[model samples]
Target: MGEWRRCCDNAVCGDNAVCWKSDGVKLKLQGENIQPANENEDLKKGCYNYGVDIADAIVPEWKELWVQVEPEAECIWFGEQEASKKPNGWWSFTFRNYLGKSVIRIKLADGREVVTDPIEVVSPKTPLDEQCDPLFYPKFLRTLIDDLIRYLVSLPFDWEAPTEFATEERTQPPSPIFVLHVLAQHADTICYALQTIWRNPHRRLVTEERWVLLSEASSVDADTILMMLHYPEHLRPYRGNSLSTLAQRLKSKVPERVFERRVTETLDTPENRFIKRFMDIVLYWCDELKRLGYWEKAKSHQPKLEDLQNFVRFLRADPLFADVSELTIFPASSQVLQKRDGYRECLQIYRLLHIARAPIFDRLQDAIDNRRIDQLYEFWCFFRLAETLAAVLGDGQRPYFSTLESDEGGLRRDLSANLGNGYQLVYNEQFEPIWKPKARKKLSYSVPLRPDISLLQENRLLVVFDAKFRFDEKDIQPNQPLEDEMDKAQQEGEIERLAKHADICKMHTYRDALKCRASVILFPGTKGAFHCTNGTKKDNPCLLDIVQNNGLKGVGAVPFVPKPEK
Candidate 1:
């Protein structure tokens, strides 16, 4: 014990405390945490040391209290009992309400700091089989981002730069937006295509048997002279007083005579022009990625961007393109780009670039790189719901409104679509109308609550939905009688437990206050079709009943996940 204490002299200590070294920290998952028995053991430790859904709370267990964490996170805190030293004198903290990927540095009181591995916080209802494999979360995140991009692109809205006569609110602004993610996604294919084109570029025969002065000739040869026979004008220059004299002079002066050459050139071909145009686009994106501060936020993507830039630089300076003119016209319809080996890959690159230039995708990489899985899920749900409603309710005639506004808090986006059949879908907009409310008109009467989505039929509120990235069966389960002991246990002031049922309770508020036909909670989970009659204490099994009877009453939860189309 004496030797151990002497060796641990550098460890952090409290008043009269025994010197201790932290034996590493472990996260204890609580509150609807999913634990699969067959979870892969290989993922037990590393960058992703522990996995928890956004809804789950994790308690961090460490050996000492003097060991602090740097950049204190808002989501972590200590409960009353946890704040005080335990019977064994161990201090603790909990990751109560947090989402996204994050890491912390443990700063011991002894002035030593150690950075921990990354922790992944994903959506509770993520459709991927994360219970047994946490690695699936990244793949799921990518798929969700793609769906969001597709959704935004599908909106029937055109962007125009705001002019002096147009107000910023009324006129959409044109901004120079580059889609770096698209280039990164197709980086491999673009590099390979450039290489193939460099090795075997299409060449065209520019000139046929053109004569050049002997002094300017690279080398004199018999073929060079023989080719000049096709051009009799050149023979005229060497003609003498007699044919024999001319022939003798031609033979003797063959080494000094004018040379005729047939030229095959690579520059100025359709294939080379197409490559030049592609290089310009790639280089533009590479420059934009750095200028827009994207590289600083996510350093991992920097290497790929650099590689793409360097390869384009090499292609531009290649000997084959030494005389290639700048691209004034793109050979978009040329057969060389569509059929040739190396140039064919450029076609694929063009397709990817088209997808990458989607509207509102400029901010997508920020969400992805920051590991904002919850926001990604919300975007996917918003678009999926809109598409589903359009399909079921008939295609939209025109957008009721669409706006993307920027302020000190960043961009604020709202979209509304008129579904032709007297149905309209609105996103992230206020409930009240611009004008005075009519009798029986559905609008927020008290504090305005803007649900994520609202459906209106013939200018009357039909229903409202809020996309929730979290769900726990325990919170939605029917209330059951509890014994005295259990009842007392519930009263111990568990704040997390108290808020678990807040989402469903808020749904009731939306139904009652907004006076909508139905208020539904859309979440990514298996808890489907949890139906209940509005203002009823008893649980009802039918939402169709409320809708069919033309009653202003229905509340429930619906499960939603954006699956790929068949």
Candidate 2:
């Protein structure tokens, strides 16, 4: 008899898949058991010459795959395409301290390989933590532009395609403007992503400075700038990752066209022209003020050149002004220029922008960026989901809405189910027009997950919006105590009951679950700041944390007071 033997009784069955290692024999034959030939086999191929199958790798999808391991097992290296690297394989099954079964996932992939399950051994179980940031990153935010260029330039897609930008060298001085020319079909995605980022409570987008003002419009306020500069860490999933809401919106509400009608043409009535002209005046004044400041006594100390360049580019392209007012560089008479004031001096710059792009003001400028891209994406997901949302909701513009008896009107159907974060989950798009009156009557929910708000947008997409409100100890009205400790403990029973609703919406995962759309939460606002929520699944993470605006129709804020440069 050899030193190792088969621990499991072969007498049990023929060519079975179970192999216990206490026999200390792997790949080696023991005793007179007479097992199959070629005891040692290539693990990756999943079979030994003797039909002994070992599933070493698996295709790691949403439903996690696992491999079992004994306290001491053979080297099961988990590398993607090739067995070149070892992440946990190096530890060599000595992970008892990690727990009884330690499960690790193969993140990326190799097509032919399945990150399958049940290796010859199973370790302890460990909770996997998400590693990436939930917020929209600059690189990711710019991906559409970069990816679009790559996609277009590489039309052939094969090796014959161009490897560099098509604009390289051919276009002189590289147009300062970043133009993304995509198929109109895909235009919604760009706008959708923009709105998503803008609505992210954690995001602070990069935008132009609108210092000019028409009589009706004032200089872009500090609150507006601040709104553009912030984004959230995570956001709820909406319309099942489709920006159709945005697309549908653009279809009927072409912002650019709307702005043109509202700003340029007297569609130009007396009130409008007065309003527009006043903006003209304000713009001229702002420009003059900036230009004056450029040469101000303090100019010697700061980065005025960079500031000047920004101001120049802004005035030239600002959507606020419809024409290059003769006031800016033309050095208009005192009547037009008025007393050279503060930022009001730059008002003349408004004239230049108006003449060039009056018709497409909203195109270059967003309502969210009307110094804000937003219908509010945070708790709701997708700032102005627009047409896509309508499409998702199908024809039912007002779908059903569901909430908990304990909760009131905001988005979070039941806030506690979502991890401390108030927003999470996205539902199907078919449940419309109205939700079952929050009675004990179970509506359409077939799954174990219940979203925050279940309603309809555009009548096609079943919409869900969960609201998250974060209040600091300081911000709570002066009367409320920060910690109502005694009440919280007692409230647990009620909170748990509230959380059971999570099960209500989970059953909607029909064969075609893709249609089972939803948005987890709707953020009204938080601490007078922004709000955000991460989606239920890992794949569709929030674009960013802080939604770009203050849960308003667009992302804007009214500063209580203004201070020069804190």
Candidate 3:
């Protein structure tokens, strides 16, 4: 809404690079239904909001970006590649727009990079406030992550199995480094669990017997020495003469006594040592967070850096831990840590951390930083579909996995969860031309086809769903005018902007090629409609109705918007 101005404070430049000019490249956002940049009041000073939909902003397509660079700059870089300067002192490029924030950088020949303000691209379906509000997107994502961790823990997963890092695959759950971000997000919970256990930490009485000189001994346990001397007379012969000889030697020269000490409520128990190890891990994570720039990103949320440091400091300064040595090994046999109140809670946190450490749970920071909402939305839909099927149908066995590589050199993962009554839900399972197994009864006649979601009954493909992060208003709005009302040029222009037809064709391709009963399009919209075989439908059917009643007999689209439950 306001005139574009240079805001140098918000922009970040390389430490070694000179801050020559912050706003070296001027950007003009050109499109229809463009909202005011300041709609997200919390937006940074140099950031601008660009809307994609001319009318309906559901799906994103390439958009024009006109840039004017300062004449002094020898080179300009949009992202990693250098931009080609035009003859008119301007540069133009088409950006594949999506809902998230991205920055533009201009690198000078003098090794100085001029980082400009970020650009916040908003999808037509996304509300500006929800996209920018920390409480909305960030909190919702955290909740989803928490739910995922809970679900993963409940299943009998092979947590220690070897798994490779997440490549550029859209289907891999997450990267291993994302575990650090998950910890950062739940840092507050970690602190609370730590503090609670530290106050009333598990302790056990330790009893020990030490041999000391008679003059130095405070209290002697004669029974302990007497017990050693009282071994059965017949059994002593087999034990050996060395024990008897040593006992007699001890009595004559050194005259030592056995001093038995009973120390009560000692904090040096295995459980307490386990707690100390957890603290050490957390301390190490704090340093990792700083190194990865996670601490800076997490400043807006709870359990601040100072809070975490103080919690560690408080634990270390306590005298109770003075005798507790560093944990050399995990106390796998300790039942107290697994079942006790405060200790059990800490163990649960540790389990979550352990589960998160696997090189899965895909690009979460990108979702948080608005680097890629499309991928994030796809993941959300995958989980949502799985949850919906499991709840509607009955719960089945734990998930099974299959892996393959995409033609694009990315890993393609297929994870399937069983739903009772013979239904199975799968994510990113490919329908290939040559399939020895895993495809069950269905196979693609041509190239491989991978849908975002697939529902199978008795190992037979029944229905497929493809998640699209975009939507056109023409498909969702009610009481639309006839196409004849618009001129030929106007209709052509509208056709060029909307993607509903192309999406429908893709669904048709999946349904026909895979020989599935139905295919559906899942998008972030407010309405869902079904187009059935029996053309007698009076109105559109609800998404649930299609899944439960219609048996997914037809192709259609549904609104699967990401909103937190009340």
Name model 2 segments beyond 4 Å from true. 1-381, 384-458, 467-488, 491-566
* Candidate models: Cα lDDT each: 0.53, 0.26, 0.56
Candidate 2 lDDT by residue in tens digits, 1-566: 12222335456433322332322222211222222213423222222211222232211111122223333233333332122233532221121111111123222222221222232221111001211211111111122222222222222111111442211112121111111111111223323322332233121123443323222343434553343234221122334334456445434221111101122221212222332453344344335534532112222222433343344344435443343233222333433233323212233222322222221112222211211111112212321222123333234332211222222422222211111112312332133212446533233444323443343322322334443211121221223332443245237633322222222223223212324333333322222222122322232223222121121121111111111121
Tens-digit lDDT string for candidate 1 (1-566): 01111112224322222221234432221222322212423322221432222211111222122222223222222321223223332334344444465443444445545434343444434433443332245445545654665444334442322551222231322222225545655667788888988887888878556456656776546877566564445553344444456467555223334655566654678668778877887787677756754433334455665787899888877778877787777676788888898788887666545532234444445555555766677667666766666666655443433443432223445556666577777776565533444422337767667888888777877788887666554556536532333444358644344444666678888888788888877765545555546445333333333333264356776666655322
TM-score of each: 0.49, 0.18, 0.58
Ranking by lDDT: 3, 1, 2
Better of 1 and 3 by TM-score: 3
Task: List, in order, the clash count of every candidate structure.
Answer: 0, 151, 11
Candidates 2 and 3 compared by lDDT, better number? 3
Worst 10 residues of 1 by lDDT: 1-10
How should the candidates be ordered by TM-score, best one leading? 3, 1, 2
RMSD (Å) per prediction: 12.6, 31.2, 11.4
Question: What's the lDDT for residue 263 in model 1?
Answer: 61
The clash tally of candidate 3 reads 11
Minimal lDDT window, size 10, model 2:
554-563
